[model samples]
Target chain A: MKIGMMSFAHMHAYSYADSLMKLGNIELVGVFDDDLERGKKVAEKYLTKHFSDQENFLRTEMDAVIICSENTRHKEMVLNAAEAKKHILCEKPIATTIEDAEEMIEACKVNGVILQIAFPVRFSSPIAQLKNLIDNGELGDIVAFRTTNRGQNPGGWFIDKNLSGGGAVLDHTVHMVDIMRWYLGKEITHVDAMVASYFHDIDIDDAGILTLEFENGVIATHDASWSRFAEYPTWGDVTIEVIGTKQTIKVDAYKEHIRMFTSGAKSLSNVFYGNDMDFGLIQDFVECVQKGKEPSITGFDGLKALEVALAAYESSEKNKSINL
Target chain B: MRKIVYKKLEKIDFATTTAKVTIVKSADQLTEGIETFLVDEVNFDSVINDTDKVYIPSTLLNVVNENLYVYYELEQYPFFKKIKEVIVNPKGVLRFRRTGIITENQRLIASDLVVFSAILGEPLTIQVKRTTPAVTPYHTIVTVNFGNGTMAHLEYTFSNDDEKIELEWSGIKQIIEFNSAEMNPFSLKNYTSLPLAYSVDSILATARKADQNVLNRLEEFTSLLSGGVTK
Candidate 1:
């Protein structure tokens, strides 16, 4: 199978490229980036072709393409990929707007191509185990979920609203929301949120706390913030506390780590040694496309998560809980 | 220099179980041996039956001081220094809620007494109504209010099947940690490792220094515990 990367706007594109290279019987057709310099640099680093033109990159004999463009650029890229008859594994927050997301999903459907969202946390071992335990009724009935997905603010394009859509609420909320939606097998019915820019002097929000109610009567609270300082052990973390009637299970995605306290560093740093979630996600996408099977995480899953995040922004703006 | 020897009783009927004495010049040695001799050697059942009123021990107060000392030396972490209050809920029920600066040598007496009281197997001071018997499922929440618009939440949940503890410190810098699970009580192989923010050697050296300070504050801590000091 031949897979080409659409853009290197997001950092994960490099990791996904590494995943593609490691897999057997798959060829990394090369990369395409709107920024010619970045495209050339990444292509040179990977020792592959750099297609400066989008049309030429899409016309290349590739079976699938992974889209890691900016949030706002996702729609255009997905539409282009669909028209080119290429299967897509797009990055999360599928698009800046719900309408854009719906259009992307429709375009993929009309083109009869698989559109998988990069929800890599689903591939984490601890998360998979937690889901299994919940499915086995080990936690009786999940009454509520408290989740956090926080990262240090990645400046530049991320802070630019025109490029990245929104701020921490948009960038961070969807991953946990997607996981909860998958775990409960329910849609969020309502959202109440408070977003603030308390941490940074930037124009966009850096912190958000959202409360969501699922159709299955499960209430969840999510803290999506770029609150970690530079000295933090890792870049960020995703933690979920599943509170049930019988028992509670807490899942920390980056828990598999060794804490090292060196003399030079100001604070202790955690060295994580966990399975590469991106590798697992890429492998699944490849296998699904190979077997003509539906993606484990569909584009609609992306749309559902995006809807909740958008609602969170709306709730914060109106200072009232928004019904979904 | 002073030597304080603590004896544990084997049976409630007996006056003492066995007596051991260790001579030390400072409070550091007192703390080092207190855990071994006072906590480990005592027969839990005997201690429960023999004491009618739970008295907060001066040695236990030293432990809290030692903790504060270490925290102070370790960059004066805001979570430790800014703690304005602590609410401990053992067995998933509200037990004691004391409001004051915990790091202050003067304000820790009441809080220290509460911990010492719980360790003695006395029923926790019930501040709120509980639906279930405050037993069986063991869970404790040590919430430390920073008074600076922030707080640290330390929680421990233990059941017959499993045991887990979590600590979350947010604001400025955030740390969310879930401690390792404890499966069997009898198995010496099971151990929960504390995540150290500093190197073990540095911490040990700092601990030695902090122990001396803890000892220096011992008199004041004990005086507060004895209710001899008004403030």
Candidate 2:
């Protein structure tokens, strides 16, 4: 499949771009970035042409486009991509607001193109196996979920609440929320959260703990934050503990690593030897486009996850549970 | 360390995850040679051969469903007890979060509120959320906000033995994690609370049928269940 990448704003764009090169069947058609310099440099590094204009970029011969724009700019890019009759693989927190998310989904549907949201956690092998177990009733009736996706603050436009929608809570909560929804096949009924800018001297929130209820009557909690320091062994962690009628299972997605001690700077670190979840995600997207099948993770899935995350902010500010 | 003295008594029975320790009441309990025990608890004494093991009352063990050493028995639990060895001063805590999946017989929420109240002042507001499976409440989450902008959240669920737990304290610059999976632990330090378990009359009376903390939480859960004003 020929895939063009829109906007290299998100850091994940680099990883996805690398995955694009790794897949033998994929052709990295071109890259379009509003920032001409960064776009040209990325295009040159990947040995592809750089499109300076969105019109010309969309006009390129590409089956799909991966929208890795800023969180606030996702809707505009998705609408443009859909108008151009190109399938889209959009970065998460599909849009900043529910209206934007709904509009994005509607446009893609009207255009009759696949709109897949990027949720790489679902691609982790252990997570996949856990899903299988749940589906097979190996764990019995699903009861509760305890998850965490805490990472170090990725400084930049992320600190700007307008650009990133919010902060750690918005940035981190969507992934696990997507996974939970997929596992239970239910919608979040209510959201209550405690959010604050506790770590860094920033205006946006840096820490948040969310308590959520699902349509299936399962209660869950997620601790999403930019609370890790520089000395932390790895960038962050994505861990989940699922409780069921018969058993409970805990998983640390990034736990398969070797703890290394070096002599010089950056002394202690964990060298991960686990699956590249991004590659798995892109591979799945590529398969969907090649097979002309519906996206495994639809835009509505993205919308539902975003709704919970947005409600979390409202829940914290209002100090009450926000019902969907 | 005060020497723990005990009288020969009926029976002392307790256990960890692996082995079960039973001290039979009579002098004939031990027929073999001197058996040494790395003692941490006491209930009664025995005329068993050698070791100078002190008598500990049964009140010491944090029992759940007749199986001890499951939940946050901070006094002897290696991991949580680490909190005493580490953080000598409990100040400037930004937030606190604790999550546990355990078995509970009562609709009590945050049974261990004393841990939070000890550090962060009295909770300004306690918010309770419970999950009812059929009739019995299977889950409860209590979120407490202190007047000083400090917030603590505790989640508890019933019929789950996944007791590997952790207590977290978010300080200004660092996060303190006191979890069940503690690494190379040091000797437990002396806590200020006198051991009520070792008291003479502790065994005679109903040994902590329910502490004040658990009772208060029970009241809160009760009120919440009845649609009380939730803040």
Candidate 3:
């Protein structure tokens, strides 16, 4: 399969590009990034061609395109990729607005192409085990879910409102939301949030606590934030505790690491040596495209998760529970 | 069995448990020179001025008289007490995001309130979401924002006959986990006749500083657990 990357804006793009090179029977045809220097740098590292013009890049004979532009640009990129008849693996939180998400999903549907959202936490081994436990009724009926996806502030354009849309709430919430919806096969019906800007001196929210109610009467809470300090050992985490009638189980996706006492400024750290979820995600996308199967994590799935995140902001603004 | 999990006890007779105190169910049970009255949380309003000393069982809403003493089970848990000490200072730590608690009983979040207040000062908002309709629910999650502009998320799960409390904050290279053991007796952590005085004062200040809406939500939560209604 021939694949092309739209941009190297989100850091995940680097990991995905690396995965493309390692996987068998796949070729990263080229990379198209508006930022010429960054595009050139990544293409050079990956030993691929770089295209400055997005139209020229999309005109290439590629089966799929991975969209890793900033949050606001995802819609334009996806629409353009769909117009060119290239299958898409768009980053999470599909777009900044609900309308944009709806449009992206519709554009792909009309073009007869698959649009998959990037939710790498769903690719983690522990998360898969939890899903299996729930599916097999090993944990009985799930009653509640407690989750967290917190990371250090990825400053650059991530904190910019126009570029990334919102702060930690937008950046972090969708990953766990996608995981939960995938696990329970239920939709979130309500959202209540306490959004704050405490960690850094930024005007955008650095932290948010979301209280969500599922259609199945399951209550869940998620702490999504960019609140990890500079000296903290690792980046952040995606952890969940599933409360079932028979048993309760907890999964920390980034837990498989060795504790290392560093001589450098970061005094202590956990050296993660687990499944590279990013690779797993790219591998799955490749297989789906190879077999002409619809993407497992569909664009509508992305829209549903984005709805919960957008509701968190609306709930914060309205200061009341938002029924979805 | 000397095991007391302290899950919102409505009729715990401190008189029977302690050596010095006495429970005043009626005038006959009261001693001739009964100077103190041990009362649970709900009856504090009725017996405000009836005694020189009131042994508060679980938690109180507002700051009452100086005679009312708060006995927090958190003081008995060495691990939580150590965390409380760190939270009060928090000089080097940048931020503490979320706290997860699991236990055998849905014990009062009184100690949690104290701990959260120590981190985030006065609570500006309080919201509770529970999983089951069971009076003793299997799961409950609470979100609160303090007057200091910081927020805290706490999740409590009632595991059957097993006790464990796990507090987690992630993404800094290290993930911390705490598993609970049986609590020991309280030590001389405070001054004369005032145990957990700082904590009690902070919780009261939090209550006093909170808006009426926040307090009402807390009241509703207590009522729901006690099989009653609050107007």
Candidate 4:
């Protein structure tokens, strides 16, 4: 499969490039970003060529396009890619609004193009195993779930409300929300959330906490914050604690068994790094494309996740429970 | 001179990989006996048997072999309980052997109390200490200034042949700046006061049933914040 990247502004854009370049079945044809210089730099860095405009780039004899431009720009990119009869691997939250997300889906369907949301957590090995366990009744009924998706502040367009939609909640909550929907096999019926700007002085939220109740009466909590201190060795941890009727499962993707001691005046911070999630997710996407099947997480899955996030935001805005 | 002893914990990098460090501390100069411990980035729990025999936690026993001794002043103004000793797990990724232990000084710190990520990676040296360090909500940056000294060349080179790596050591360094400062961690209670989607009603109801006062939870939670909050 020949893959071309539409933009490099998204955080996972580089990871996608790295994945496509390394995967045996997929060959990267070219790459582009909104900025020519940035696109050229990324292309050169990844050992790929650059395209001057979207029109020319879409016209390339590529099997697919990975739309990683920006949250707001996703709709147009997907529409254009679909018009070119190119399959899409779009990064998540799909779009800033449901209208745009729906349009992206419509365009894909109209053009009979495959559209996959870039929700990498769905492809996580542990998560997949956990889902299987739940499906197989190994854990019985799930009682509660607690997860933390944290990181250091992005400090870029991520802090801009208009560009990124919202702060940590919109930026970080979608991943967990999407994963929760996948795990619970139910829709998010209600959300009550609180957002704040405790860490960064940015107008957008630097921290957010959402408490959710799925339609199946499963209770879940998600802490999506940019709270890691700069001095910490790594960015942050993504931990999911699932409490079932029979057993409790804790999935920590960041913990390593290795330890270090320091007798010097300095102190120690952070335990591990490199969850390798991006690489893992991208590899799965490439494989799915090669197998001629829909991605495990489709564009609709992305939209559903966005619905939960939107409900959370609406709940926060209204200071009340938002019923889906 | 006053000295503080801390155990090595886990080492974390930018990619969320952790390396555990286990250590044994003995005060040969003052106290007799040994102190065994398991340290990670978060918790330090251990057992002290006699003055000479310290039973280090077995979970981290594989990572460390030899014991280390850290010495601090026994006679301070008045904070001296016993000889101050602690096993530090730098990253909160591992657990100690036991739940709690009493130091010689009689200070009963919680087994899970952790000094947040203070230092990691290669060690840097500082010459001067500034009393009022610049602070960000997430970190404290200390600046070291060494105006003019001919002999103080600011940098040196050292590497043990056994370590198989060369290390450049800079003597006098400054923090220049730090942004993260201490803040109270945020918990589930803080969100109760904020408006939310109705889908969370059940969760909020459960929180309420757990004896949390919904109306005052926000004030109490936010008031507890000196600055930092965690999930």
| Pairs of colliding residues, candidate 1 | none
Using Cα atoms, each model's DockQ against the true complex is 0.07, 0.20, 0.25, 0.02
The complex in candidate 1 yields a DockQ of 0.07
lDDT score for residue A44 of model 1: 89
Give residue B99's lDDT in candidate 2 (0 to 100). 40
Model 2, chain B: what is the TM-score? 0.46
Lowest lDDT block of 10, candidate 1 chain A? A192-201
List the TM values for chain B, per candidate. Answer: 0.29, 0.46, 0.45, 0.18
The top-ranked prediction according to DockQ is 3
Q: How close is candidate 1 to the true structure, as a TM-score?
A: 0.65
> Once model 3 is optimally superposed onto the true structure by TM-score, how far is the C-alpha of residue B196 displaced, in angstroms?
16
lDDT of 3 at B216: 54
- For candidate 4, the per-residue lDDT at A207 reads 58
Candidate 4 residue runs with Cα over 4 Å from true position:
A257-275, B1-231
Share of true Cα-Cα contacts across chains kept by each model = 0.11, 0.14, 0.36, 0.00
User: Over the stretch A146-238, how does candidate 1's per-residue lDDT look in tens digits?
Assistant: 788988898888999999999999999999999998888889997877666756789998877776778776666677888777887788899
The local lDDT score (0 to 100) that residue B3 gets in candidate 3 is 11
Q: State the local distance difference test value for candidate 1.
A: 0.64
In lDDT terms, which candidate is top? 3
Q: Output the lDDT of residue A305, model 2.
A: 90
Higher-scoring candidate on DockQ, 1 or 3? 3
Worst 10 residues of 1 chain B by lDDT: B124-133
Count the clashes in each prediction. Answer: 0, 4, 8, 64
lDDT of 4 by residue, A35-71 (tens): 8899999989977889968998988898888988768
Residues B1-231, candidate 1, lDDT per residue (tens digit)?
A: 111222222111111213243333332334432322222231222232221211122333343321222212212112222222232222111112221112232323333433333322342111111112133232222322222222222222333443222234334443433222332233452332222122222222222222454445554434443442210
